[model samples]
Target: MTNITAGDVIFLIFCFSLAAYGYGVIHYGKKHSEEEKK
Candidate 1:
């Protein structure tokens, strides 16, 4: 089995962070639009 390196871990963390940030932005935008319609 291959061992995991620090670089691999860092890359994974970066990808996850980007995904989370994108999701948060989309979620907030949806909420704001719905609120404006009310």
Candidate 2:
């Protein structure tokens, strides 16, 4: 097996951050639209 380097850890963090940010944006957007529709 290979060793996990700092770069790999950093890359994983970056990917997770991006995914969370995207999901937060979409979720907030939907909630805002639903509120507006009321």
Candidate 3:
């Protein structure tokens, strides 16, 4: 049970980091395009 809980925590962290990275890439792409338009 404890091992499963540890694995869950690690999986959650990995998911959150992946989400954050995706958001950063999307946000930067939008900003770059706006700057180019200006």
Candidate 4:
């Protein structure tokens, strides 16, 4: 019981941050090409 309380929260936050960063990169990539054409 003690193990679950200490470790799980840290792991979840780390994963969530990575997912957010990936989304931002994809959005920027899509927009950048459009600007270049103009």
Candidate 5:
């Protein structure tokens, strides 16, 4: 089996961070738009 390297761990963290940020943007965007409509 291949060993995991530090670079791979770092890349995984970066990917997860990007996904979380995108999700946050979408979630907040929807909330803001709904509030504006009220």
Candidate 6:
């Protein structure tokens, strides 16, 4: 089995959270804009 270090885990979490936050922002913005238009 391959051993993953603490640094690797932290980096993975950081990247994942960053991507998730960006996705959420984009999704929320789109939704809000569409709601405003209606």
The local distance difference test score of each candidate is 0.89, 0.90, 0.85, 0.79, 0.90, 0.90
Question: Any residue pairs clashing in model 4, and if so which?
Answer: none
| lDDT: worst 10-residue window of model 1 | 29-38
**lDDT of each residue in 1-38, candidate 6, tens digit only:** 79999999999999999999999989987878756644
Candidate 3 lDDT, 1-38, residue by residue in tens: 35568889899999999999999979987878766644
TM-score of each: 0.72, 0.74, 0.63, 0.58, 0.73, 0.75
lDDT of 1: 0.89
Write one digit per residue (lDDT tens) for candidate 2, span 5-35. Answer: 9999999999999999999989988878756
The 10-residue segment with the lowest total lDDT in model 4:
1-10
Provide C-alpha RMSD values for all models, in order.
4.7, 4.6, 5.0, 5.0, 4.5, 4.7
| Number of colliding residue pairs in model 3 | 0
**What shift in Å separates residue 38 of candidate 2 from its native position after superposition?**
22
Number of the top-ranking candidate, with TM-score as the measure: 6
Model 6, C-alpha of 4: deviation from truth (Å): 0.5
Clashing pairs in 6: none
Winner by TM-score between candidate 6 and candidate 5: 6
Backbone clash pairs in model 1 (N, Cα, C under 3 Å; residues 3+ apart or in different chains), count: 0
- Residue-level lDDT of model 4, residues 1-38, one tens digit each, is 45565468888888999899999878887978766653
At residue 32, what lDDT does model 2 achieve? 83
What lDDT does candidate 3 reach at residue 9?
Answer: 87
Better of 2 and 3 by lDDT: 2
